[model samples]
Every structure is written in C-alpha cells, then in structure tokens.
Target: MRSPLRTLVPLALWLLCLPALAQDYVPSRDAWSHASPSEAGFDPARLAAAVDWARANGEQAPADLRDALMASFGPREPDYRILGPVGTRGPANGMILRGGRIVAEWGDTARPEMTFSVAKSTLSVVAGLAYDDGLLPEPDQRVSMQVSGPWFEGAHNGAITWTHLLHQTSDWSGALWDIHDWADRPDGDDPANRVLHAPGTHYKYNDVRVNLLALALLELQREPAPQVFKRRVMDPIGASSTWRWEGYENSWITLDGLRMQSVSGGGHFGGGMVINTRDLARLGLLMQRDGEWNGQRLLSSDWIARALVPSRVKSDYGYLWWLNTGRTAIPAAPERAFWAAGFGGNHVYIDREHDLVIVTRWTPDLAGVVTRVLEALEQP
Candidate 1:
C-alpha cells in the first residue's frame, strides 16, 4: 500500500500551483499580449539596458553561415564539409517573457535563423512524445531490442540504452551519413584511431552520435520525425508555420515504403531548426509550464521532470538541455533554470521560479544576458 503522506504531498503541491497556473496568460495565433516592464514587475531602465547589451553583443560569426561553418569547424575536423542546407544568418534579436506575456523584445525577432544544437532539445521532446505514446516503453531498454540494425550490433554498441543516447554518454562508435563518430571534436592528431569507452560510461559531444539518435527515432516513429513534431507539439503550441526542420542531403531513407528525411540534431553539418525568436520563446514557455499549454497537456510533466534531471556523467546536461546546476553555466540564474543552447549563441532559457522565458539569437554572452535580465527583476 502507498503511504498517505506520499499521496497527499503531491496533491498539496498541485493545489498550491493552481492559482499561479490560472494567472498565466496564453497567447493566440494572431497576437501575443504585451506587458510593460513596470507591469511585469521589472525595472524599466534596467530592462532597457539588458536589451541594449544583447544587441551590442551579437556573435562575431560571419553573416554567411556557410563561411561561418567552415571557419569554425573545418580546421578541427578532417574532411570537414557541409552535406546539408545552409543559410545566411540574421542580426542579434530576442524576447523576454514574464507570466507568459511579452515584456521586452529587441531586433528582428521575426527572422527565421538556423538554430544549431538547440534542435537537440527539441529532439528530446520528440523522444518523450514517443515514450508517452507507448511506442517506447522503457528508456533503459537496449536500442537493439526496439530496432534491429548494424548500428547497434557490436559488443559495445549493443550495450547502449535509450538513456545513454539521451545523455550523450553512449560513445557509440560508427559512421552515419558518411561522417565518422571520431571526426567530431576528436582527440589529438589521428581521430579515426581514437579509443572507445563502454556505453553510458563516457560523455562526448558528437554530432555523429546525435544523428544516430535521430535515425533511431526515425525508425521507431515509422514516419518523418519532423512530421511527428509538427503534428504533435508545434501545432498544439500555436507555433508559427514559418519554422522548418531540415536534414542532410544523404539523410533520407525509405521507411515502410515511404521516403522521409531523418532530421539532423544540430547544424554542425548544416541542417537543423530554422525558427524565429517568438517560436523559440513558445518552446521555452512550454517547458516553463512543465509541458502544458493553455490548460492542455501536450507533453507529460513526468517526461519534462525526467528530461531536466542531470545526467550522472554531466551535471550541467540533462536530456540535451543545458542546466544551471551549481550555478556554473549561468551563475546569475536560479539553480532550477535550464535552457536549449545552439551553436552561434541561440538560446531559450526557462526559469520556472520567476515564471520567465528568455530567447536570444546570435548573442554570445549568455551568462551576461542572464545576469542583466535577473538584475532587472524587481526585488520583493
């Protein structure tokens, strides 16, 4: 039998959170409600200063993202070249949301730009949706059990579970889309000969491994991952139709006699999410509300909690999301805060304690941005 106290504890917390949830403003498709800085309990002058700082601190990458990609990663990885679509980036822009309404915005918030590794966080949501739909029952189950393929056939690879892949600790060695796992941020001079660690025992940020996750998800979903994402999450959240998720030229495969692209998890080889700041803010807001939107639960709260839990090997990382644990990643933010960060400085920060969602684009100083935003909040 379950303890009475255990049952009542959750009930009590839900009751306490009810009023706050009721007070939140949900935006419509046509327009987002706005609140002045003073109305949102922020210091107006300080908030203005934060926006100015963000505008002045845009990342130094060239506007031509193809050039930027070559300049940033070409020298580090062998045979580095883009195999997917690339686009010219826009200038710095972002928005600050408090209580689910816009409090401040700057620059071209409507421009859709490539969001690199931030797509990883969105991919995590896609995985969670699969888990909720009963397609994926256990996160700790071996990948080989769900789908039979050469990717997970080896001794080390076969041992990997969904949890390991989600945490970026699988260290699954292989090449997908002709890109070797060792070629991504490899060690020393010879990347191809890099040593491999046991599954779930090491943490390495590799796009090849991430793309493998996408492929695995594609196989399980039996349709394009982006289609699932659009139908399930984005549509329910009222996200604009402008956002697009792309995969590489070679990433397409026939599934169930249907040809569909397996979307890349980041823009390392070029394709990921191309979205505006507002749509990004909507994603952050969904996370801030624990996967609920306008009283409808698009994603399970349990999944959100699980996704935000720090991985054993990396405290600052949780299911592809970046955490502010130990105040290391964002010193000025609350400890419970977490975010989706991409290459080229895009971010979608979720601060539940403050009922805040902050989205930044092409801004390198994430820590400074958080500090300035927090400093602008009115003191009790």
Candidate 2:
C-alpha cells in the first residue's frame, strides 16, 4: 500500500547498501588465468598501439637503467620473500616519478589494493585540510575542550591535545595492548587509562591516540571522515577512484570500535583506507609537490613545511609523516626526503629536492626486501 516513490526509495537504499552492487566488476583469477590480455581489458591491438606511441615518444628507458630495474622484477627476490610473507602470495607493484612524470612503473598499479598503515599519512593530510578549512579546533587546544565525553574527564586524556595526538605523545598508557581488548570493553570511561608521561615528553606508537584523533575529526565535521576527505583533499587532487576505510566486522561502531569491518566510508584510525596504487602514487606526488597539483595549491607550503618538520618524539617523526634521517637502510638522498611507510612493505617515499616520489606495494616479507629496496633507491 505504499506510494510508488516511497517504495522506490527503500529499494534504492537497499541496493546502495549491498556491497557487491556498488563495486567495480573485476574478473576472477580463475576466469582470466588462461585468457589472453585482450580478454583481460588489455586488448592486444590497443597495447601494440600504446607501445608504438611509447617508442615514438622515446619513453623507453635507457638500456642500463632498464636492466637494473628489470632485475628487481618478478618473484626472484628471495630476501623480499623472507621479509614479506603476506606480500609474496600476490602481485608486487610500484611506480616511480621524477619531475612530475612517471619514469618507471611496474605491475598492476591501477588495481584497488590495501595499503595498511599508509592510511595514517592520508589521515595527516585530512587533518591539515580540516585545519585550513577551519573545521578542526586549533591544534594547541586542549583535548578536554573539544571532547567532553567520559573518556577525557579528570585524567591524562583531558590533558591531551591535537598536537600531542599528532606526535604520538598523548601520555596515555594501556594503549599498547591489542586493539580487540579495547574494542570489547563496555565502559568508555575507565580511569586505569592514565598518563604514563607528560604530553610531548615521550613517544610511543599508540593506535588509541590516533583513533581518538579520528573520532575528534568526525565529531567536528559531523560527517564520515572519508566524505570530508574527498571534498577537501582527494577530489581537489583529481583522484576519482573509489577507496575504502576498513573496520571491524558487524555492528557499526565508532572509528574506535573494536569489532569493525572494512567499510567504504569510515574513520581514519587503525583499520581505515584501502586505495589503489595509482591513487597512492597521486597522493605521494601531491605531497612531493608541496601540496600543489595541476597549478593549484591544495595545502599551503608553510603547512607542508610544518608537517614535514620532525617532532620531539624522534628526529624523524613529522605531523604524521616519517622523515628519513638516513638512519634506515634506505639512503634518502639530500637527507630532506621523507616517507609514509606501513607494515607489509607499503611505502611512499617523497624527495622534494630530487623531485622524486617512489611508491611500492608489496607482500609482507620475512627476508630483507625492505633493505634491498632501500639500496636500490640509493642507486647512483
């Protein structure tokens, strides 16, 4: 007995809610295992044409660079296999850009894939945008001023601020435990969570602090974090691809919810953001360009400078980014280069002076693949 428009509205909402319905259709591995490239969206004729254009435009690499680069291709890197166990079972893809043009690219760089904690770097950008747009309260503002919920009352949480959260110096303890334990607790107001050290005095990679930051952003914006991201950051940069912020399974929880599952538009805490390699490259390029893209300044140069400056925790910890002090195996040239690295060998290495950005998406390795990649980057 419902009106026709009313009936259609529910049906539309139901269709929108279905996961498979909204996703881009991709061929299953089994279906394309034996198929030709033409059958897999890479038509032979088109590919040949593209190759001809490349040759005509002199886009082919120099003989020596080609050989050196190709040597690292395929599944032959035993050290990488050992270092990244989860990564070897799948494709390892990467892209390299110099002077705003792709110099070398390999593997399936266009596919939507997981980037683990690389999401944190993206979250940092979001915070910068929020600050620029006036959505976020001032960075020095006390946490107690913004969030009045039971979590910040009369404890170290009250003393926390956006600056402290960004630097991983919120002084909160009991955050080192696995995420599942925190998710299962019912009382959001537990006093056992106290300051282990004064804010800005120490550094610990605490997921809870970042998760709380995500919550604060959501509360300030009054919308899901991803939408805010799209409007302020991603779309402005011309990345139109769909990405997701994964969460725990069942029962939609806050960004900090324990049992969340991977959802399309969610918060930016621990389990958020699944983007394709191409978009990831775009993001790196944006950062490398000092927040400018296609002739527009998305973020102020001053802001980027501040974000890349090291914090008190480490000589390398920036606003959420990681600066390379040449301490890691990766000999970051010019010593001004920085990176946003994640578990399982995901990395976005940005060198502003060199006008270079390198993005790698690889399986988790047990061997020293990370060290080898760093060595490769240091190549003369």
Candidate 3:
C-alpha cells in the first residue's frame, strides 16, 4: 500500500497540471491594435492645422485639386481611395500636393512607422551626401580599395565597384531573397558568396547586396550606419524623428528576423525610421528641388541626376530609387515620375513635371496599391 504522503503528493501534482492544461487563452493584439488611426499616428486636428496654415499663407489648393486629393482616400468609380488598402485590406494613409503646396494630407503625420523597402531609396540620399562630402570615394572606385577584410581577398570581389553595388550589378552571387537561408549557415562567408550570373548581366533585387553597401559605408566611416545617415541626410533635411537601423542581438529577437535582415537598413522597419508624414513630405520636396533645401545645396545636382536616371536592370529602377514612368506594367503618366516605395503601402511619389509630391503609409499588403495610387493621380 502507498504511504499517505505519496497519495497526497500525486493528488497535488494532478491539481497543478489541471491549471496548466486549462490556462486562459488570450489572443494577440499586435496587428489588430495597430489598425487604429491614433496608433498609426493620425490626428485630424493636425491636418486641420496644416490646412489652416496653407490657407493663411496662400498655399491652399484649388477646389478641383482638393476634390482630387479627397478622392484618393477611398475606392470610388475610379478607385480613388488615398489610403489605398491597408492592414491586409487597403492603404492606411495618403498625402497629395500640387505646385509645391500641401493640397490634401491625411493619417498620422506624427507616427514613426515602418516604410519597408522604401528605405532603400532613402539610403541613396545618404550615399549621395557621403559622396558630396568627399567622405566616400567616387562611385567608380573599386570596393577592394575602400574595405579591408577577408571578404575582399579575390580579384573579382576586390574589383567590385561602388557603381556596381548601386546598380544591383555587383558580382556577389547570394540572392537578397535568399539571405535568411545563407545567413545562418556555418560558413556564411564561403567562396560561393562571390558567385554571380556575370556582373551587370541581369537585374536581381537582393537585400544582402544592399546591406553590403551599408557595410561598405561603415568600413569607410568607422561608425554606425545610422549615425552616418543622420549626419548626412536626416539632419540636413530637418527630419526631426527617431530612427534606428535593425540588427541582431541576444536580449531581443525580432518577430521576423530573416525578413528584417534583407531590408536595406537591416529590418525592424519601424526602428529603421519613425518619422512623421510631414517630414517625409519635406524630404520628398527636397529631392524634387534636386537635393537642395532652403537655398542650401545638401547634395550635388549631378548626384541627384544620377539617382533619378534609370539603370540597365530596368527602366523602373534607378540607384535604389524607383522610376515611375518609362517601361513597366504599371501605366505611366506623360509626366515623368519616380517613387520610394516600401512594403505595405508606404510611398513618396515625386512628379517632376508638375513639381508635385505624394506621400502615404499603410499596413502590410501586396495588392495593387501602387497601381491604384498612380491611377488616382491621373484623374482629371
């Protein structure tokens, strides 16, 4: 017969296990909580303030332009919702301007949020600043000369130039799409890393290739990439927001580690930047002005020209920037346009012909948000 103590102990263990099996189930609100306009950084009052300023300063839009701007926020006969489709639905936010004035703006301008691959286009501005400052070598200089490490040991690897990296034509073989698979391999730096389909042969979008550009910048400056970015680009543009470049660490692991690593700024899209919409608009405006702001030349006009011009890979892609017009499945307006597009619906649309800019943000979705927004702009 079992001792009384043993019988009691088993009974206690069973009681404890019951609670473990019946633990309360609480659903996660991470994504759902973000759907609110306040959470996304929107305040109707702030928009009113901007409108008031525009009115007082003679910067307001005409009635027709205002109607066009409002139509962009919803799906109508012409599909004019400005926010597009957001949060697996449609675009969450949008902005519109004409003649260098804020015609229509919406969503949270104060929310610091993720802009996805759009950050890549912004990175080009940082590189431009470095070039203008003489901190970085000419685009034609070989990577081997700029960086010192085992990675640059071979002739071909060493011969890879900044221009090659910018154009996504670097002879590096690893695909940006496959970075996660290769990142954790025991031999991350194997010779296979240098494999490529002939340099400049094709246009393949790769995050590691872009990250290497960041690494190259780090090697040149001996400082963190974010620091260089702030000093060179953010501060000059008067972007008052907190942003950080994502990276690996022990204490905290990102929800999507691999996806984060592939981005130009190492992922953590929100951490990569948390700027208000207005600041983003200002940056777009500065680019529209050819890298000059407030009469100060932030970057050489020549550099801006190079960035806006299409590359060999596709008519749509320029050094990190996305050219809107030319040859693409997306319909192009007669006016040449370029954009900085992020995952989700984050966008900085620049129209050179009309001197206009449209900025927007939205939750993650792969729908034809880009095409829709462009169509909205084409409205008479």
Candidate 4:
C-alpha cells in the first residue's frame, strides 16, 4: 500500500505547477482576448505612454519604399537599383502581448506592411522545419551535398555549409537575379575586385548570399518555402492569410521539371515578407514559447536552441535572429531577449524572461520603445 506521504507529495507538486499552467495562453484563429495593462502586470499609464511615444517616432524613410531604397543604397552601391517590386506603406502601427494576450495596441495593427530583413527570421524558421523533417541532418553539412547548382561550386564556395549561410559568414561570391554579391554593401570602392574571405572565417551582411540560402532550401525541400511555413507553422499557430512571402521577379528557377520562384531573405532588392503586426506577434509568441503552440509541438525545441546560439564572428547575431547578448544591443532588455528586425523601423521583440512580445512598425527607436515597455512592468 502507498504511504500517505507519497499522495501528499504528488498533490503538492501539482499545486505548485497550477500557477504556471494557468498563465499559459494561446489565442485562437477567430478571436484574440485582451488584458488590461494593470491585469497584465503593467502600469496602465506607463504602458500607454510607451505606445504613444512609439507612434510619434515613426520611420523617416519615404512612404514610397522604392524612393526610400534608392535614397538609401543608390549613393553607396554601384548600379544599385530595385530589382523586385516595391510599394507604398501604411502608417505607424503595432501591438504588445503579455502572456499571449494584448495589453496595449496602437495604429493599424492589421495592415500588412513590408518587413524587410525581418523576413530572414521567417526564413530561419522554415529552415528549422526542414531540419525537423530530416531534410537537413546537420547544420554543418556542406551545401554542395544537396544543392546541384554552381552556386556552391569552386574551392571557396564549395566549403560553405548550412551553418555558415544561417550565420551570414559564408562570403559566397557571385550573382543571383543579376545582382552581384559584391554590389551589396561592398567594403572597398572596387567591389567587383573586392577580397573574398574563406567561408565561415568572416561575417558580412549580404542579401545576395541570403537569397542563395533561400534557393538552397528550395532545392532541398523541392517545394516553395512559404508553403512549408504555412502548413507547418502559420496554420498551426492560427495565423491569418493576409501575410505574403515574395521573391525577386528574376529569382525563379526550374527544379525537377517544376518552375518555382525562390524567396528573398530581405527587402534590400524589394522582395520579402509583407505581414500585419498581429500575425508578426504570433510568430514572436511561437518563438517565446520555444516553438510550441497550445499542446502541439510545431518546431523541435532542439532547433530553436541551436538557432539562438551566438555566432563566433558576430556575438549579437544568431541564425538570422538578432540578440541582446550581454545586454550590449539593448541595455534595458534582458540578455536572453531576441528579435526580428527590418528596415523602415519594423521589429518583433520576444522577451522570454518577462513573457512579453512587442511588435512595433515604423518606429525608429526600437530600444527606446522596449525600454519604455520594460519600465511599465509592475514588479513582483
């Protein structure tokens, strides 16, 4: 017969877990519940001030993104021009989620807007899905093993790996969609003859190389990445159909008798994700919860852990996701906090320690907005 102490011990443990279990929440497709600032452990006035401050500090870029792109890169890069589609944008907007419920919001949170480099984070998630399905056995696996193109050929590019691509250290040379790799934020005036570092030896932020990764993943999965992301991630998380993933007009390729367009990793050349703040918040919530939605496991926890590990060359970056490692990036935020950032001041911040997901669009100062939100939290 079991002793009375055994029964009491189990009951006490269950009681201890009750609070945590109650705090966990996942919004459904049709409805999203809301919690007042005070109810969500925030000072109501302070949270409101933060939202107001963010709205006033919208991006300084031109409303016409094509003009903005040209003004930003045309002067620096030789022959730099938009090769993909660009469009006008909406006003500043965003939402704040505490414990999976909205605590405060402002602007047109439902309006879809171009989220430039933030799409790289979405690409990272799609890669994580490929990893889960055994399509990619190891991050260190050489890209040449799976991809049958000249993209990974030659001694320098031949040595590149999936890890190198994800960390932005591949230093892959060449052009895709007629845009040369050296033309992207080139170092020296002579970009065409710029020095090439061995793969994995140096870190460089290059959109052309990122697009190569998208193409490689397309080859491995033999399907469009957006489809994989929708079926495995977005749909399970109850994301609406408003979000879109796009690539350059010339980025199309023929794979196994099917013509498929490879997606871009950012909007530097004018193609990436255009998504609403609410759906963007949902992605953040999924990352905050370790890729688990409700009771379903979407991405393996192992993949997320690997993705968050800081790269050797860049301590503040991890698998396309930006980090606040050592509190260097955002002093007010926790070191474990990570985010997906885009041009035109779009960002989705996931604060795991505080159970917070803050989405801000067209807000120039992300750190300032985040600091304001952190200050509003009521101390336990």
Model 3, range 83-150, lDDT digits (tens) per residue? 21111212255555543445465555656655656767777877787788787658878878877865
TM-score on alpha carbons, each prediction: 0.94, 0.64, 0.63, 0.94
lDDT of each: 0.88, 0.55, 0.53, 0.90
**Shift of residue 169 alpha carbon in model 1, Å:** 0.5
| Candidate number of the best lDDT | 4
> How accurate locally is residue 355 in candidate 1, as Cα lDDT from 0 to 100?
75
lDDT of 2 by residue, 1-380 (tens): 75979956764564344342122222221221122323222334543443233223321222232232234322332121111101111356666554445545566676665565677777787778777777654787886776656555566667877888777777554331133213222123553443257877887664456666666666565556677678766776667456666543331444444432222111212235667766787788788778877677788786678777778777778888887665543452546777787654567878654445667765333113223323333222
The positional error of residue 257 in candidate 4, measured at the CA in angstroms, is 1.6
lDDT computed for candidate 2: 0.55
lDDT of 1 by residue, 13-86 (tens): 64355343334568887789888888777899999999999999997458999999999899989899898899
Global Cα lDDT for candidate 4: 0.90
Q: Which run of 10 residues does model 1 get worst, by summed lDDT?
A: 14-23
**How well does candidate 1 match the true structure, expressed as C-alpha RMSD?**
3.4
- What ranking emerges by lDDT with the best candidate at the front? 4, 1, 2, 3
lDDT of 1 at 87: 92
Backbone clash pairs for candidate 4 read: none
lDDT of 4 by residue, 200-318 (tens): 88999999999999999999999998999899999999998999899988999898898998999999999799889999999999999999999889999999999999999999999
Model 2, position 38: C-alpha lDDT score: 30
